[model samples]
Target: MSKALDHDPDHWPRRLVAVTPVLPMLPILIVCALVLVGLVDGSGVTWVPLLATAPALAATTGGPRGVLCVGLLSAVLGVSLGIRGDAADGVLAVALASLLVVTLACAATSALRGRRERVLAAVRSVAEAAQQALLQPIPATVGPFQVAVRYSAAAAEARIGGDLYALVSTPHGVRLIVGDVRGKGLPAVGTAALVLGVFREAAHDEPDLLDVVARIERSLARNLGTDDFVTAVVAGYPRDGQLEVVNCGHAPPLLVRDSVVVPVEPVRPAPPLGLRTLSGETPDLQVLPFADGDQLLLYTDGVTEARNHDREFYPLAEGLARHTGDEPVDTVTALHGELLAHVGGRLHDDAALLLLRMPARTEAPAPREPSGTVRVESCSP
Candidate 1:
């Protein structure tokens, strides 16, 4: 039932709200009321005169066809009432002419409304086209890992946002960046484009992960103002069994290793891109083991900061541990659905999630003593 309703973009409640009684039926009810009035008070002033109201009521309720139907009905009933009440022909003619004018005016209103609806539809189509261009779809697999992304824009009409993520397999490794800009609307989208453009170029050209971060920082510094900034997490799998991450004042990335989920926080956090002058520190680079069967989840603040009506934050780590598995695509899909349910259907801010899973090697890698310490967690922050 839920899926059926979801598939239908328009729900019952909205349809009910837009509904109106059949315009032709309103005239019939009005004629019945006038007849009742005349039967109750059989005076010289015939209650049949009230029949003029039928056409006006129909015009208010119906479109062009309805106006014509009600107009003819009102005219026929008016003529019948004149003869039945022993009224003059001039009185009936005047009443019928007034109803014709109102019906014509109402028809014009419906025509205007139809034109406006067509214009609105065209505008929405253009916006959707631009949205798809800006956020190109990502493939299911990239390099040695399976990748999945779920993004939702707060503004439903525009359907585009500043929450950004991109994954590219470079000479150094499969590099990825997920970030969110400071504000909302067109300005935020502009900032997102700048960040993605630089990241895509630098991810391929820059060998050192820090150099990739520096290139992005330079581009943002030159393009954005003091108030603008983007919090981001950039990660790379330079080799099998290893992952490098750089955090720039964004939510920590979740490391899923050996069935455990840990948020890898930057040892010394730097300010978001384009605001480095305030913090005077560069983003910290952290490395962790990316063994087979391990996956890493990178996301923006919109995910962690999402809250329910009771003012409770969504437990990211707990949610990750519950839904996550070996398949990155399935894990992210489950998490995105649960996240929407947690927030009661819509998020106030843009939300983004990216999951990448390392596939098992053909001839399994020999068990070598771990080279670096890996933080393991299964707790909530």
Candidate 2:
């Protein structure tokens, strides 16, 4: 039964391939129809045979090469047919002109294909290099945190885009950033890279989370386009079980405790980084009490904005509630898969998720007595 279904003629690709043989014959069929309609007499024989070459030529050669090959073959066949039919001057002139036109067109199209291929190759290389340098890998573990991150670009074939995530261990603590630039493609990627680059450097030098964010903002404003901006959440763990977060027009991070999800409310959110001129006030840092076994989820708008066929936006919190538990990596992988399924296997915008879990602390064992001197005799032994 499966083999029969697989071999069905209704299969899409099979049907397309089945039609391939007829494609080369279509022009010849058209010529025959025209001849039957008395479009021309025996003089049209040369043109009819030449037309038959069109489909085969198109199929075998692409751009200029195919056009040229078809034109040359058509001209040869036309001349042969013309000689056999004792064609008139008018017929011979028309055949030669048609061949010349076809040859020129084929040459132009082939040149165009070559140029387009080169441009596409260059763009692909740049995008790949940009992804490597801007989207640094987020280790499965960082500091006292177990981490997992998933990133997807809206543009197919591109693995990275305007959305960015970075997690690094610095002298201060574990610092991370999850951000989305305001646009897409090369421009957006440039801004994202700039912001992340600055954040990584500042996260080490600055003691305060807000200072790190400010540094990123300054760098973006200096380097990015006038209208460009980045919405982001910058966070740091200060080795004191407290998570410091600064929200800059980005979604609030979620805190998962005991398998229940709660959004970390921003005390005050400043406008996105590049808009510092419009809103001068800096974002106020909020300290969240993060105990062992707690997990924090940071994500871009792509997660919340994904919609199903019914056009209903995905309920990330609800999805998280249903799938995520104590394991950070498992929770993230499950949510990422669910999110993809919810969106019908394709995301319309770039999506990114970062999960960090603080493992439950183990109590320290009692200190051992000095081995050499601590022989309290064999009291009980």
Candidate 3:
């Protein structure tokens, strides 16, 4: 059966409290009320026939054990009501038979539901493990830059998605890549994993930033389908005072200098990662002056393409400009909160944002002379 996975780990407490303790006993309460009505009315209509409702209702909220308990209690209440109302023996027998059938059926249903829940839990556990292995977390700082990243998957249960980002400090310098796969679901996830694997490996091996990008493109071309391609930006700080960026059909990264936000558009446009062969164009490496107090923000299309109810796309560049701060973590947090607010709390597609900031360099003070040792000073009169 195709149904929504309504299990949310965040709201499980509220859901449990709503359905437990009080709700499970509702069936017994109903049976008691019906018994009181039958005894008070003394009608020939025989309300004992309604006893089957107790077990049927129990199936909706409680488990198999609770359903059986409700069914047994209802049968006893029905017999008492029957005797008090002077009902026929055949009527009481039929009520008992119906209650028995309903209770057994409800018990079976509860068991089936429990099994499905277990299966869903197992699947969710495996998904979490896969997410940990595939998309490892990045620390707050890498190399000489303060970094922060935020990612959201459209599938709530599947926390990982096609959008990927990684930052590593290598012998050459700090290397990073932020990219988005062309689609969603398992296929897109596979493509994303492939790209990240190559990037991480090549980021360490290849000294040149463009060579790292080329290695990723070569791997994707061999493994990915003809139509499948990834848009990415590969960046590196191979030496002091320089930032090398290679944009492969991805959105231009926002460069923040002295709290001013500017998009670092590629000098030469290039096709996406896997489509270089078809486009017949090679990616260009652009090196910029990355002085202290300069910041760069790399992101996927998901951030820029996200739309609100009025169908207006998110203004990422403007948001960064407004929320720019000295700390990368604070800047990314503000931007993420605004993005969610813009989309009305949930994004329709995977979104990733990575911000790296170069802290202002400070000069150390000169060493002071010891106070205990008195030095003879010659003064010219």
On lDDT, the leading prediction is 3
Task: Provide the TM-score for each candidate, comma-separated.
Answer: 0.76, 0.71, 0.84
Best by TM-score: 3
- How do all the candidates rank in terms of TM-score, highest first? 3, 1, 2
* Error at 118, model 3, angstroms: 1.3
lDDT of 2 at 308: 83
lDDT of 1 at 285: 81
Q: Looking at model 2, which ten-residue stretch has the lowest summed lDDT?
A: 372-381
* Candidate 2 clashes between residue pairs 3 or more apart in a chain or in different chains: 64-106, 64-110
Q: Taking the tens digit of each residue's C-alpha lDDT, what string does model 1 give over 1-381? A: 001112112243346555654545767788777766664564312554466567566655556676677667756665666666667777756766776776677677756766777798898798677665556566666778777777767666656777888888888889999999999989999889888889988999999999999999988989999889999999988887889999998998898888898889899978999888766888878988888788889887777888878978889899999988766666765776666666666677787888888878763333322111100010000
Go through the candidates in order and give each one's C-alpha lDDT.
0.73, 0.71, 0.79
Off by over 4 Å in 3: 1-22, 25-57, 362-381
Per-residue CA lDDT of model 3 for 251-358, tens digit only, reads 999999987889999999999999999989999999999999899999988789888789999999999999898767667767766776676656777887888888
lDDT of 1: 0.73
